[model samples]
Structure formats: C-alpha cells, structure tokens
Target: MKIVIAGGHGKIALRLTRQLAGRGDSVLGIVRNPRHVADVERAGGEAVVLDLEHAGVDEVAATLAGADVAVFSAGSGNAATAARRDRMDRAAVVLVMDAAEQAGVRRFLHVSSINVGCADDPGIGEGYAVYLQAKRAAEQHIFDRDKLDWTVLRPGVLADGDGDGTVELTAGNPIAPKRARFDQVAREDVAAVLVELIDRPGTAGRIYVVVGGDTPIEKAIDV
Candidate 1:
C-alpha cells in the first residue's frame, strides 16, 4: 500500500516510515525541512517538502495524489506555546483532512493524545487541559466528517523502550489509574501499529488507544 505521512521528520513519524518501508510498502513523507529528505530516504521513504499549516487544500491534495492512506502525526512539541500548538496541532489537522478528501484518500489515521477526554483530575493540570482542548477540537472535526474512512489512535504517555507491540486498547472511555510509562514501547512499536491499521480493514471508523505490552502488535490491535 502507498502511504503518505505528514510530519515525517517527527520522532514517531520517522519510526513509522522505516517500519512501512522495510515491509516493502511505498511510503511518502511530507516534511517541512529539506534537510529531512536524506533521513527519510535513509529510512526507505521518499520525502516531499510541504508545510501543512500554510499549504492550501489543492496543493496538499496534489501532493497526496495516488496515495492510498494518509496519517497525521504532526505536532508542535512541548516547547510550543498554546497558540502555536493550536495552530499546528488543531488547524493543521483540519487542513490535512480537507486535502485528503479532495485527493480521494479515504483511509486516514490521526495520532492523537491520550490526555484528551481525561476526567477532571488534578493530575491533568492547566497546561495539559489546554492541550486536551486542542486535541478534542481536532478529533471532533474528524468525527463530524463522514465522507472519509477515519480512525483515531490515542496513545498513552510515550515511552522509549523495547516494544514487543503488546498494549491495551479501549474503544470509549477507557482509563487507567496511573499513567502508562512512556518508556514502555519503543517508537518502532508505535509505527508497527500504524502500519497494521493501514493494512487492516476492520479498524476503520474506530478509536483506539495504543501502548506497549508483552503481546505482539497484531494482538494488541485486536484488543
């Protein structure tokens, strides 16, 4: 399958690109920096320089032409202020969705945050609240649009450990008492799940929260 990944230079995005490319799937990475092209190519994916925040729908659609799936993994990172976060995380996702629709790429995956939809807990403070609001708004936009095949994967706190691909997933309102360790799964495991979702048909129109566990990535998807 041909897959296009937005924010290809991102930590998780690069990992996903390598996994897909290693498996012989064609991968196209839409990156903002030209310097990232070599890294993407080194991972076995072609890189296209484009800024989703400023690119028009037609221009993005043209870039996505012939792609079978598109994944939005772009983020402003923790260093960004609230305004920039909203612009890049929320608004950019909307732009990508519009472009995907225009480009006729129906399979869409949104890599969202697990902090979204959290209860009114003290652990989730003001800063996290703002992030949650942005993610929620972006997710609402995707849920309201019925024209495309879309799925939202909200992962627990990211960890950078060895990923056997085992993780828990809940459809709606699934919560854990303590935050899952970010170091539980390596970035490669997260990429594994994304690639599996692209190839698996049953996951369409669903919301899944992914994490690392002892089980294989495929079984984690079944959860």
Candidate 2:
C-alpha cells in the first residue's frame, strides 16, 4: 500500500512511517521543514515539504496522487496559542479531507483525541475543551462526508513505553477510575492499530478508543 502521512515529523507519525516502511509499504510524508527529509528517508519513506495549514488543494491532491491512504496526524505544537491550534488542528483537517477527495484517495484515517466524546466529566475542560471541540468538528466533517472510507482513532493518553503491540479497544466511553492510571497506550501500539485499520474494511466509519491491554493489537480489535 502507498500511504501518505500528514505532519510526518510528528512522533506518532514517524512511528507509523517506520512500521509501514519496514513492512515494504511505500510511504510518503508531508512535512513543512526540509530538515525532516533525511529523517523520513532514514525511516524508509520519502518526504515532501508542504504546509497543511495553507497549501493549495490542487497541489496537495497532486502530491497525494497514487497514494492508497492518507493519514492526518498534524497538530499545532504545544507552544502554539489557542487560535493557532484551531487553525492547524481544525482547519488543517478540513483541508486534508478536501485534498483527499480531489486526489481520489478513499481511505482516510484521523488521529483524534479521546476527549472529543467525553461525558460530563470535570477532568476535561478549559484548554483541553478547546482542543476537544476542534477535534470533534474535524471528525464530524469527515464522518458526514460521503464516498470516503474514514475511521477515527481516539487513543487515550499517549506514552513512550516499548511497543509491546498490545492494545485495548472499546466501542464507547471506558474511562477508568481517577486513580487507576487514566488509560495510557504506547505510541507504537497506536501506530500499529492504524496500519491494521488500513486493510480492515470492518473498521471504516467506526470511532475506536484505544489503550494498553494484555491482548495484542490485532486481537484487541476483535472487541
């Protein structure tokens, strides 16, 4: 499969690139910095310099031509203000959706936050509320569109632990107790799930919440 990753320089995106490339898949990473080109290549993928926030639709479509799947994993850095976050997180996703449609790529994967569908939980609010709102809007845009095989992966708090490849998946809210480790999953495991979803037709149009578990990621998907 030919996969294109937006925000290719992101930690999770890089992990996904390496996983896909290692498996003999053609990977293309869209990045804004030229310095990341070598890193993408080092991970066994090609890199293209393009800013998702302002890139022209036609240009993005051209870049994505021949790609089988497009993954939107871009986010405004932690240092960015609220406005920038909306632009990059919300607006950028919309742009990617448009470009994917124009490029005729039907499989779209969005790396979204678990906060988007949280119930009336006090633990989520303020700055995180803004982020959640943006993610929800972006997700709705993709879900409401026709002719796209879209799946949203709402991973819990990400961790940098070893990729044991075990993951827990639930159809809906499954927040643990306040003191019970608040659902954390390894970044590599999340990437692995994304790769599996690319070919798993049953996963399309579903919103999956992923976390660490005793079962391997592929088995966890049976939930």
Candidate 3:
C-alpha cells in the first residue's frame, strides 16, 4: 500500500508513517517546511514539501497520484489564530479532498478531534470555539462528498507515551461520551487505529470517536 500523509511532521503523522514504512508499505509525507523533510525520511517515509495552505489543488493532486490513501492530519495546534484555523484546519481539508478526487485517490483518512462537538457550545474560549467550528465545517464537507471513501477519526485529548493498544471506538452520530479518567489517548494508539482503518475499506463513510479504553484496538474497531 502507498500512503501519503499531509502534515507529515506532526507527531501522530510521524508515528503512522513509521508503522507503515516499517512494514514495507510505501509512505510519503507532505510537509510545509523543507527542514522537516529529513525528519520524515528518518521515520522511514519519503517527504514532499508542499504547503497546503497556499498550494493549489492541482499541485497537491500531482503529489497524491498513484497513492492508495491520503491522510489529512494537518492542524494549527491549540494556540493558532482564527485565520490560521480557518486556513489550515478548515480550508486545507477541503483542498486535500479536492486534490484526492483529482488524483483518483478514493480513500481519505481524516484525523479530527472529539472537541468538534463543542462548536456550538458558548462556554469554551473563543480560540477553541473557532478551532472546533473549523473542524466541524471540514467534517461536514467530507460527509457531504461522494467521490472519496472517507473515514473521520475523532480522538480525545492526546497524551504522551505509547498506549497499551486498547481503545473504545464508536461510530455514527451520538458518539460515545469521553471517559473521565482515561479520556486522553496516546498518539501512537491513534496511529495504530489509522493503520487498521487503512486496510478496512468497508469503514468508509463512517465517523468514529476513539479514546483509551479496555477493548483491544482490533476488536474495538469492528464495525
């Protein structure tokens, strides 16, 4: 399998790249900074420096050609300005979807956040509110599309260290509520889920919420 990851330098993206490449699958990471190219290569994946925020659809499509899957993990983090959130979190997702269609890539794996459900809540901070709104918009765009076999994975607050390979995965609307204690998930676990989803084409058109739990990842992902 040939996998292309946007935001190739991200922690989760790097982890995903390593797992895929380590198993002999071709992996390519698209990053904005030229300096991150070495990091991607070090993770056992090829690197393509392209800033999706400014790159045209055709430019991105060219990079995704012949790829089996396109994973969108790009984000502006927690401290991004509203503009950055709209550009990267929202518009960049749309750009990748368009590029995937143009390049004939049918599978799209989106790394979203569980916080997107808070988009309509007024209690959150303005910055976080904007971030959730952007995520919500991007998700809606994917749900409305028909060309790509898309799967959105919304993980809870991220934690450090590798997880124990256990997770609670729920699909469709009214997603499972976050656990009070094990709400945070390890980045490596999220990557593991992505790896499993990559081979499950039947999981397309599904929205999943995953967090640390008792069920093993392989069993929890049964849908």
Candidate 4:
C-alpha cells in the first residue's frame, strides 16, 4: 500500500515508516524540516518537506493524492506555547483531514495523547492543558469525518526503551495507575500497534488506548 505520514521526522513516525518500508510498501513522510529528508530516506521511505501548520489544503492534498493511507503523528515540541499547540496540534489536523478528503484518501491513522481529558483538569498547567485540549479537538474532528476510515491511537507517556512487543490495548480510556510506570510505553510498541492497524482496515472507526501489558502485540489489536 502507498502511505503518507505527516511529521515524518518523529520518533514513532520514523519507526512506522521503517516497518512499512521493510515490508515493501511504498511510504512517503511529510516533514517541515528539509534536513529530515535524509533521515526518512535512510529509513527506506521518501520524504516531502511541507509544514502542515502553514500549508494550505490544496498543497497538502496534492501530496496525499494517490496515497492509500495518511498518518498524522506530528506534535509541537516541549517548548511549545499555547498558540503553537493550537496551530500545530489542532488546526494542522483539520488541514490534513480536508486534504485527505479532497485527495480521496479514506484511510487515516491519528496519534493522540491518553491524557486528552486533562483539558478539563484544573490542576494541569496552562501549556500542558492547551496541548491536551488541542489533541482532544483534533480527535473530535477525526471522529466526525464520515468520508474517512479513521483509527485513533491514544498512547500513554512515551518511553525510549525497546518495545517488549506486549501491550494492553483497550477501547476508550483504560484505567491508568497513579504511578507513571504503568502508563509508560515504548515508542516502538506504539509504532508496532500502528503497523497492525494499517494492515487491518477492518479495525477502522475505533479509538484505542495502548500501554505496556501482558498481551502480545497481534492479540491486543484484535479489535
């Protein structure tokens, strides 16, 4: 399948790109930084430098045209202000949705944070609150798209260690423990779940929360 991944330079996106490309599927990663092009290519996927925050729907649609699936995995970095969060996390998703519909690409995979509900948490700080709010808004937009076959994956706090290939995947929000460890999942594990979702179109239109657990990757994705 031909696939396009937004935020191609992201850790999870890079992992997903390599997995898809390794299987001989055509993959193109859309990145804002020109320097990241070589990284995507080294991962065995083509790259297109386009900043989704400023790019118009037509321009994004042109890149998405003829693509079988589009994945939105971009995020504003740690130093992001509230305005940047809204633009990159919320509006950018809307732009991609419009472009995907216009390009006639029905299958879309979106990455969201498991803490999206924190938008309503009074204890959360302003910057983090806005980020969660933006993610929630983006999720609603994807859920509302009738023309798209969408799967939203909300992962808990991401970690850097290699994946154990086991996860606890459940519908809606799973019970997150007080300790962050229960929620700490490896990036590669999240990427592995995405690969399964990409191959299983029958599992579309559902939202899943993934974290480290005892279930095997393949079995956890039996949605």
Candidate 5:
C-alpha cells in the first residue's frame, strides 16, 4: 500500500509511518518544517515540505497523486488560539478532502479527537472548544463527500508507551465517559489500529472511538 500522511512529524504519525514503512509499504510524509524531514525519513518514509495553511489545491493535490490512502494528522502545535485551531484542524482537512478528490485518492483516515463533540459538554480550554468545533466541521466534510471512502478515529488522552496490541473501540456517535478516568491510551497502540484499519476494507465510512482495552487490536474494532 502507498500512503501519504499529513503532519508526518507528529508523535502518532511517526509511529504510524514507521509501522507502515517497516512493513514495506511506500510512504510519503508531509512535513512543513525542513528540520523534520530527517525525522520522517529516519522513521522510514520519504518527506515532502508543504505548508498546508498556505498551499493551493493543485499544489497539495500533486503530492497526493498516485497514493492509495491519505491520512490527516496535522495540527497547530500547542497554540491555544482559535485561529490556529480552525486553520490546522478544520481548514487542513477540507483542503485535503478537495485534494484527495482531485487526486482520485478515495481511501482516507482522519486522526480526530475523542474530545470532539463528546456529549457536547463544552470541552475544557478555550482552544479545546475551538479544536472540537473544527474537528466536527472537518469530520462532517469527510462524511458528506460522495467520492470518498473515509474513517475517522477518535482516540482518548494519548500517552507515550509501547504498543500493547489491544484497544477498546466503539463506533458511530459514541458517548464519552463522564468521569474521563479510563481514557488514557498509548500512541503506539493507536498506530497499530491505524495500520489495521488500512488493511481492513470493511472499516470504510465509519467513525470510531478508541482507548486501551483487554481485547486484541484485531478484535477490538468490529467491521
């Protein structure tokens, strides 16, 4: 499989890239910073520098051409501002949706948040509220597309740890836990699910909520 990942420098994206490329798949990582090129390449993927915030459709579409799948994993890094949220979270997804359609890359996997519209509890921070709103808008855009085969993944409170090859998954407008105590999940585990999703054709057009669980990763998500 040939895959393109936006925000290839991200923690989760790096893990996903390493897994995909390690398995002999051709992978291209979109990185905005030149400094991050080595990081992606070290993870066993080629890198392309393009700032999606300013790039035109044809420009972005050119990069996605000939790809089998596109993953939207980009975001404004730790900037608690509404502008950054809409620009990176919402506009980036919309841009790629257009580019994917133009490039004829139908299979898409979006890295959405577990906080997005989670019972509409108004989220925590000012930026988080904006981020969730952007995620909803972006996810809606993907869901509305007639030509796209897409899946949105909502993973809870990401942590850094080795993959356990296990996850708890729920589909379609899932309710977040009120206590939020059991939401912690490893980034590597999430990456495992992503690769699994890539190989699972039955997962198209579904939205999933993910977390750590006793079930094996392969069995966690019901097709």
Candidate 6:
C-alpha cells in the first residue's frame, strides 16, 4: 500500500513508518523540519518536507495525490502552549482533511488521545483543557464529513516500553466496556494498531480506544 503521513518525525508516526516500509509498503512521510528528514528516511520512509501548520491546501493536496491513505499524526508535542494547541491540533488536522478530499485520498487514519471528548472547558483554566478542546474540535471536523473513509484510534497515556504485539482495543466510547486497563499504551503498539486498521476495511468509520492487551494485534482489531 502507498501511504502519506503527516508528522513523519513524530514518535508514533516514525514507528508506523518503520512497520509499513519494513514490510515493503511505499511510504511518504511529511515532515516540517528538514533536519528530521534524514531520521524519517532512516526509518524506511521517503521524506517530504512541508510544514502542515503553515502550508496551503493546494500545496498539501499536491503532495497527497495518488496515495492510498492519509494519516494525521502531527502535533505540537506535549509541551505546546495553549494557543498553539488550537493551531496545530485543530487547524492543521482540518487543513489536511480538506487536502485529502481534494487529492482524492479517501482513507484517513486519525491518531488521537484516549479520553478525548467534548470539553467541559467553559470556564476552566487553559492547562489540560486546551489540548482536550483542540482534539475534540479536530475529531468533530472529521466526523461531520462524509467525503472521507475515516478511522480514529484513541490510545491511552503513552509509555516508552517496547510493544509486546498485543493490544486490547474497544470500539465506540472509551468507557463503554470494562475490559482492559486502558491507562497507558506503548507507542509501538499504537503503531501496530494503525497498520492493522489500514488492512481492515471493516474498521472504517469506527473509533477505538486501545491499550496494551493479552491478545495479539491481529486478533484484537476485528470490527
């Protein structure tokens, strides 16, 4: 499969790139910094240097043409300021979605947080609430559209441990069923889930809250 991913330098995006490209899939990773291009290339993906936060839709669309799927994994990182949270998390994702539609790439895999939902930030301070609000707005932008075949993977708090090749995945709401401990998930497992979801057409239009589980990724992703 040919895939184009935004935020090529991100931890999860790089892991996913390695998984896909190691298996002989053609991957083009869009990165903002030129310095990160070599890192992405070393991880088994061709690098396209473009700042999604500043790039126009036409520019992004041109880069996405003929791609099978588009994945949004870009962010301003965990320490991003409140204003940038809205800019990078919300606006950039929406920009990429518009570009995907224009470029004729129908499949979209969105990387999101575990407990991300409508924010109660009516009067709360701009600490954690900003990130939550931004993520919620981005998801809404994707959910309200019918032009793209979208699948959202909302992973729990990320940890640095190596993946064990197993993940407990729950669909729909995060708190629906009490199955696995969804507190923290390895970044490697999150990458594995993205690949599995790409292979499973049945998972289209579905949302999953995932964490490390006992079952292998292959068996855990059935929709």
lDDT of 6 by residue, 1-223 (tens): 9999999999999999999999999999999899999999999999999988789999999999999999999887779998889988899999999999999999999998765653553544456568877887888888888999999888888888688999888887532232323388899999999999998878888889888778899899776
The digit string of per-residue lDDT tens for model 3 on 42-84 reads 9999999999889999999999999999999989887888999
- In order of TM-score, best first, we have 3, 4, 5, 6, 2, 1
Question: What shift in Å separates residue 203 of candidate 4 from its native position after superposition?
Answer: 1.5
Model 2, 1-223: lDDT tens digits are 9999999998899999999999999999999999989998998899999988779889899988999999999888766777878888889898888999999999999998767765234676566666766777787787787878888888888898667888888774223223212588899999999988887878877878788888878777753
Write the number of the candidate with greater TM-score, choosing between 2 and 4. 4
Which window of ten consecutive residues has the lowest lDDT sum in model 2?
172-181
Backbone clashes, candidate 4: 0
**Where's the lowest-lDDT run of ten residues in candidate 1?**
174-183
lDDT (Cα, 0-100) at 34 in candidate 1: 94
lDDT of each: 0.81, 0.83, 0.89, 0.89, 0.86, 0.86
Compared with the true structure, model 1 gives a TM-score of: 0.90
lDDT of prediction 3: 0.89
CA shift of 154, model 3, Å: 0.4
In angstroms, how far off is 133's CA in candidate 3?
0.3
lDDT tens string, model 1, 47-156? Answer: 99998768899988998899999999998778778897898889989999999999999989998876676534467766676676788789888888887899888877
Against the true structure, candidate 3 reaches a TM-score of 0.95
> Each prediction's TM-score against the native?
0.90, 0.91, 0.95, 0.95, 0.94, 0.92
Candidate 5, 1-223: lDDT as tens digits: 8999999999999999999999999999999999999999999999999999999899889999999999998887776578877888999899998999999999999998887664245446565667777877888788788798898898888999896888898885533333323388899999999998889878998888888888899888777
